[model samples]
Target chain A: DVKVTQSSRYLVKRTGEKVFLECVQDMDHENMFWYRQDPGLGLRLIYFSYDVKMKEKGDIPEGYSVSREKKERFSLILESASTNQTSMYLCASSLRQGNQPQHFGDGTRLSIL
Target chain B: SQQGEEDPQALSIQEGENATMNCSYKTSINNLQWYRQNSGRGLVHLILIRSNEREKHSGRLRVTLDTSKKSSSLLITASRAADTASYFCAPYALYNFNKFYFGSGTKLNVKP
Candidate 1:
């Protein structure tokens, strides 16, 4: 079975703080993604990495960035956390392309005050 | 913006009844996938149907896709209380590798 693990299950941060969410996958998948899920808004992609050092912006990448220094780890960084950034963050990994099903890690529920 | 939109934001059904959800997308897709997420948990992949395929089944779950209309339907037979969750449909475009646009999801509640 494939396992995707997130660094934190819940986090609370003050406004204007820097936040980092880490994700690691044991399957060595080539694609990693970061998304923020909100009620009525759905899961909007923030950023994605296809390979080490290669990153692509999704529909909603503002105020957020991603790092993929290694194949197994992907990190999401918030430049300046704001109250609006609070939501359920999810990390997912897939074998190669979109055709394959993505395995997700337990989401990190971030609350910004 | 959400690429896929599911019909019926919420649904309630008896335990032994079957539940069906529909999803519609705006663009052409390489494949359509269904996912289930329990309250406060990560999503679990339920099934995947490619554009060329019309219908697929796994266990008691059935998925049907219509690329011509850019829509798909998922049916859960004999739903139990445990089947209650939010179901999302994700459409993957051909040009975007590993980038999927997800629906808002349909929250289903199976009554015991």
Candidate 2:
């Protein structure tokens, strides 16, 4: 079975602080994604990496960035955390094949105060 | 607004009954996928139906796709209380890889 591991389950940060969320997949997938889910908004993509050092912005990429320095790890960075950034962050990885299903980590609920 | 929109924002049913949820997308798609998420948990892939495939089944779950109408439906037969979760559909667009648009989801409550 594919396993996607997120570094945290619950996180609390202060305003204007820098925050990092880490994700690692064991299946050697080539695609990784970061999304923030909110009530009534569904899952909006923040950023995605197709390959190492390759990144693409999704619909809501503002106030956030991503890093894919290695194949198994993808990190999401918040330049300056704000209360509006508080949401359940999800990390997912999938094979390079378009037809393959994505494996997701349990998610990290970030709280900004 | 490329996301798939699920109909009937919420649903409630008893155990041993069948539940159906529908999803509609705005544009052409290469495939449509369904996912289930327990409260506070990430989504679990339920089923995937390609544009060319009309129907597919996995265990107690059945999915159908209609390209002409740009819609799809998921049916859970003989649902149990454990089937309670938020069901979402991702309509993977043609030529768009790695980017998935998901709906707000249908909250299913199967009371035992």
Candidate 3:
């Protein structure tokens, strides 16, 4: 079985604070992704990394960035947390191609006040 | 932009009934996958169907894809209360490496 783990399950931050969400996968998958889930918007991709030090912006990358210093770990960073940034953040990992199913970690529910 | 859209945003059914959900994609895809998420939890992969394949099944779940129509359907037979969750369909385009666009998802509520 594949295991994807997130650093935090729930977090609360004040406005203008910096937030970091960490994710790790045991499967050594080559691709990792970060997404934010909203009520009507579904899962909108924030950022994705295909390999170490390689990152790409997804549809809604604004106010968010990602890091992939190693194959097993991916981190999402919020430059300045805002109330609008509060959301359920999910991390996923897949093989080289998108055709393969992605394994997800238990999401982190972030609340900004 | 969202590449996939699921029909009937919400569904309510009783236990032992069969539930069906539909998904349509805007562009050509390498594959389509179904995932389920309980409230406030992470998503769990349910099934995957390639563009060339038409039908696939796992347990009581059946999935069918029609490339020409750019549509797919998922049927869950004898649904139980445990099947209550939000179901999403994601389509992967060949041009994007390891990136999948997800649908709004169908909320399934099964009553015992």
Interface RMSD of each: 1.0, 1.0, 1.0
Put the candidates in DockQ order, highest first: 1, 3, 2
Candidate 1 interface RMSD value: 1.0
Q: Tell me the docking grade of candidate 3.
A: high
* Best first by TM-score, ranked: 2, 3, 1
Q: Between prediction 2 and prediction 3, which has the larger TM-score?
A: 2
User: Per-prediction TM-score, please?
Assistant: 0.97, 0.98, 0.97
Q: Place model 1 in a CAPRI quality band.
A: high
Give the per-residue lDDT of model 1 (tens digit) for A30-79. 99999999999889899999999999999999999889999999999999
Number of colliding residue pairs in model 3: 0
Docking class of 2: medium
lDDT of 2 by residue, B1-112 (tens): 5589998899999999999999998888888999999999999999999999999999999999999999999999999999999999999974677688887999999999
lDDT of 2 at A18: 95
- Give stretches of model 2 more than 4 Å off: none
lDDT of 3 by residue, A40-100 (tens): 9899899999999999999999998888999999999999999999999999999986688
Please compute DockQ, using alpha carbons, for every candidate against the native two-chain complex: 0.85, 0.79, 0.84
Candidate number with the higher TM-score (1 or 2) = 2
Return whichever of 2 and 3 wins on DockQ.
3
